[model samples]
Target: MMLSAQNLTLARGGVPVIAGLDFTLAAGQALILRGPNGAGKTTLLRTIAGLQAPVSGTISGADDAIAYAGHADGIKAMLSVRENLQFWAQVFGGGAIDAALDAYALHPLADRLAGTLSAGQKRRLGLSRLLVTGCPVWVLDEPTVSLDVDAVAMFAAAVRAHLASGGAALIATHIDLSIDAEVLDIKPFRAKPVHFSGASDEAFL
Candidate 1:
């Protein structure tokens, strides 16, 4: 498997949110996380991406092979689109950024400062970084936010291509990308409220 989480218990702000969560993703496959607002989907993705620690359990096969994109677009506003991609490529030990530029149709804006682009354009640039990461596992959170219809299609196409190239994806998104993927509902894994019996336990809570 490319990524697997067994009996994972995730937390936000030191309080458990989801418990006993288990999932796996192999090469050429994708998994979508489903839950309502404040359902800990972001927390779960964060843990898998190594941004934060899980309260408990094991996440295997996600050490250096994962590329993560969270709610924020991880880009340098002062850098041009091409420059930004080059930086990430160098950081991830990837190759040329030409393919990434073409993937998002950013050839025209390659030299434009990332801060000068519109919301959708910036989002595309951010998504384009995935192509330059050279990682086999992708972990994304609300990847389609601020994207137009065409931009969304572009993102979906990129994901499809990644899977075809023997990569895996774990995404927490509400929009359906029309790709072949399994859905995992986290509502069932909601953490139960812990009753405090003493002052020390209350302090921990």
Candidate 2:
């Protein structure tokens, strides 16, 4: 298994959000998280990415193999597109920056400053980090947030190529992607309600 969660419980701000969740992702497979706002999707992804710890249970097979991408672009504003990619490739131990640029159609914009790109272009740059990481498992949150249809398609193709090379991915998004993946709805694992003792009835008002 590339990633596995067994009876996992996650929390945010000392409040439980996901509980008793169990899932597994294998090589060449993808899992898509589907949920409404405040449904613990980001929380779950963070836990899986090791950015935060789970409240209970255990997660296995998701240690150093994961490459995480969150809502933020995580790119330096003053750097050129190629510079950004090269920097990450070096940090992650020298990956194929040229391939990454080509994958996202960033070759034409290689010399352009990252700060000057549009939101969609910046998002593509952010995603290119995943390629440089060379990690087998991808953990992404809202990866397609600022992308256009063609860009989304490009991302989907990249994901497909990764999976074809025996990699796996875990993604959280509201829109449909172009890959075949198992859908996991987090509603069933919502945390149990907690009761608080408060003197003021106006708190609810």
Candidate 3:
């Protein structure tokens, strides 16, 4: 298994969000998390990426092997597209910036300042960082936000190529990504409140 979670639980700000969840991802596979807003999808992805700890349970096969991208683009606005990619490539232990630029169709924007790109173009630049990371697993949250139809298609193709090379991905998004993936609805695991209707405060001493 490239990544596996067993009896996992997660919380945000002292409120339980997901509980007793289990899932597994292997090489060349994609798992799409489907849920409404406030459904803990982002939390789950964050936990798997090791940005935060799970409230309970265990996760295996994710140590030092994940590249995570959240809602924020994380790109420096003043840097050119190629400069941004080059910086990340070095930070992630070096990679082919040319390939990453080509992967996200960023060649034309390579010399353009990141601050000047449109929202969709900036999103594509943000995503190109994943390629430079060279990790086997990708943990993404709302990765396609602000992308046009053609850009979405480009991202889908990039994912397909990644999987073909024995990589895996875990994505959380509400929109259709146009890729073959196992869908996981996270609603069933959402936490429910415990009620104490009509019970006295000292009933149990």
The local lDDT score (0 to 100) that residue 90 gets in candidate 2 is 91
- Give candidate 3 regions above 4 Å deviation: 194-205
Window of ten residues with lowest summed lDDT in model 3: 193-202
Q: Give the distance in Å from residue 138's predicted Cα in candidate 3 to where it truly belongs.
A: 0.4
Give per-residue CA lDDT, model 1, range 1-205, as digits (tens). 9889999999899888999999989999999999999989999998998989998999999989999999899889999999999999999988899999998999999999999999899999999999999999999999999999999999999999999999999999989899999999999999997677798787867
Q: Compose the digit string of candidate 2's lDDT tens values, residues 99-200.
A: 899889999999999999999999999999999998999999999998999999989999999999999999998778868899999999999976766756
For each candidate in turn, the TM-score is: 0.95, 0.95, 0.93
Error of 2 at 112 (Å): 0.9
The model with the greater TM-score, 1 or 3, is: 1
lDDT of 3 by residue, 1-205 (tens): 9999999999987789999999999999999999889989989999999988998999999998999999999899999999999999999897679888888889988999999999999999999899999899999999999999988888888899999999999999877877889999999999885455556645856
TM-score (C-alpha, index-matched) for candidate 3: 0.93
Cα TM-score of candidate 2: 0.95
Instruction: Report lDDT per candidate.
Output: 0.94, 0.93, 0.92
Best-to-worst ranking by lDDT: 1, 2, 3
Q: What is the C-alpha RMSD of each candidate to the true structure, in Å?
A: 1.8, 2.0, 3.2
lDDT of 3: 0.92
